[model samples]
Target: MSTIVALSTPPGSGALSVVRLSGTNALKILKRLTSTLDFTPRTATLTKLHHPDSNDLIDEVIVTFFEAPHSLTGEDVVEISCHGSPSVVRQVIDASRNLGATLAGPGEFSLRALSNGKMNLAQAEAIRDLIAARTETAAKQAARQATGELSKRLAEFKTRLLDVIVVLESAVEFVEDDLPPTQTNQIKEWLLFVLSGVGALAESYQSGHLLRDGIQVAITGKPNVGKSSLFNSLMERDRAIVTAVPGTTRDTLSETIDVGGIPVVLTDTAGLRQTTDDVESLGIERAYRALNEADVVLLVVDGSVNADWHEAGLNSFDHKTQVVVNKIDLVQYGHSDLPQGILVSAKTGEGLDDLRAAILGAFRGSAIQADGLLVTNARHHEHLQQAKIEIKEALVALDEHRSEEMILAPLHNALRYLGEITGETTTEAILSQIFATFCIGK
Candidate 1:
């Protein structure tokens, strides 16, 4: 691959911006930028960047060099930390391009690292997850995966799988007669061990998805029922406008908050009610859509007033909906009069904790792993499922007195599926899709 260049830091005005390049020509481009030859590996040098042809001074900067095989991409890497002025950064990058460094595409840096054996596919994806993590707990989880924890675990599975494969193949090729019952029983035990481990890992994907992507929650209620007020209270800030007037919120409002290390994407939709106005009607349409898609729905109702529960759509709400009775402060009395639900005063901040707890309880099966690993990517989960299926097939073939070829066929497929998770058997098209989600310059 040719030398690739891009702005490593977020673009625009800042104290400093970093421009990174990786390829065989990275050294040449750095030399052209600074006109200094002696760039010791892993050392930072203060330098002045100048235009290549015109020799016009561009900017004073700090340059760091990471020599080949020791860098992020396992190539000669150069990083220029210059003044954050857009003009200066532009000139520096333009000068490098003139010297033969083309711009990098999304995830090109880490993709190269994976190609050069610096990291496996799982570790490379982990780096991307780390960059995009939403919460501290999510970041810690990604950090652990980035350190090859998943790859290490997968490696152990592969080793044990290979052992089973070798024994099965030997019975197919060396032993002409049918295997004795003793050896067959022992193979079953080893197969069971691998099956149990893979099955457990596959089951952890639900927890991993929640930890990584979080859950979507929709807040829906009739207008003036304190839905917006409860949205602000839940967010701990006034993100949406609150007023006594009806139809103030004619559009869906959404925000994310950290709830016990879980990122909750809370969508505050327009009040669900009949309206003649076209705009409010559209908003109500969106409210229903939000409710349909949400992992959890908060059906807020005015506690101070009484109405038919069936009219509010609360009576027919699905199991995922939580009935929240807001405005208990207005009631200002015992819960005997209020309908059966979680009573809270958006004004007094009552029952909000229980609401949050209820939101978490919706996903009781996918609790966060305190200090364990999970298959965060859906691709990984699919591969594990496929491998599990094939493993089960292999066990069935062994049990049913099937041919050695039949038993080895599914076993080989199982190995390939496992290999795909770590990129040993992954294809080019799938790799493109995986790396395409990343931002340029890694």
Candidate 2:
């Protein structure tokens, strides 16, 4: 392949920027631009870069070289660290292009690494996930996957499945001879072990996806019930418009906050109440929609007032809903028939800890153990589910004493589905789809 070049750092001015090149003539292109003839591989050299034709000084830059079969792409690579000025970055790119290097497409570098067998498809996807990770937990999970945690588990699964297939094939082939037959019960047991392993991996997608894409939490209640105040208190900033006037928030305001290492998008929707005004009606409509789509709902209510179930529509509450009674500072005394909820005052920051804990509990359900394998990708989840179905079908066929030919089909399919997870059996279309989501420089 021809050499490829791209800015490996984020756009705009900073202390410095990185421009990377990888392919067959990466070093050759670098040689044409700089005066230095010899560069020690894997060492950073401060050198002067000049235009190839004019020999005009481009910029004083630091260049690093990586030889083929040892670099990120498993090919010769060159990286230029230059001043952060956009003009300097542009000039360097144009010079490299003139020297026969093409601009890299999105994720081309990582794709090349994958194509060269430096990393599997799952590890490549994990790199993208790590770059896009929004929380510390998500980053850690992605980092672990990138370093081959999922690959190791899948490799073990393949090994055990292959063993089972080999023994079954031997049984089918040697039935006419005096060779000892493998018991059907033993085969069933082996298949069950593989099934249970895949099932556990597939089930992990729940928390995996939740951590990858954060949950939406909507605060819903009638006017003047401290929805905006609670939203501000949770965020530690006056994000929403708070005032004594009813219906001050004529629209929904949303912000993302870290709740115990899990990202929670807290949305303060307009108060739910009767309003004839056009704008307020529209706001209320949006609030209802937000509540309907929320993964978790914080139903804020006034602790000083009696239950207004008739107007608030408490009967429609689902399991994802949690009651939070605000303004407990004013209603610290006994309550006659108030709605049951976690009491707190957004004003004095009372019971806010409980509210945060409740939010985390509502979404996570139970804590995921540190450094465990998590299947976060939706495509991976689908493939795993398909594999599970095929394995179970194979198990059924074995129980019925069906012919070996009948069982092999599902077994093969199960193997194929598992292979797709690590890209051993993935199609070009799926590969393109997976890598297309990555940024250009990756």
True-structure lDDT of candidate 2 = 0.88
Runs in model 1 deviating more than 4 A are 314-317, 367-370
Model 2 per-residue lDDT tens digits across residues 1-442: 9899999999999989999999999999999999999999999999999999999999999999999999999999999999999999999999999999999999999989989999999999999999988889989999999999998998888887787788778867877643234566677877899899999989888778877888799999888999999999999998898999999988988898877667789999988878799999999999988988888899999997766744687456667888998988788568545678888899999999999888877755545433478898998899899999999999898877777767888988999999998899999998898888999878
lDDT of 2 at 262: 72
Steric overlap count per candidate: 0, 0
Best by TM-score: 1
Model 1 residue 178 CA deviation (Å) reads 3.6
What TM-score number comes out for model 1?
0.96
| Candidate 1 residue-wise lDDT, 195-226, digit = tens | 99889889988888887888999988888999
TM-score of each: 0.96, 0.91
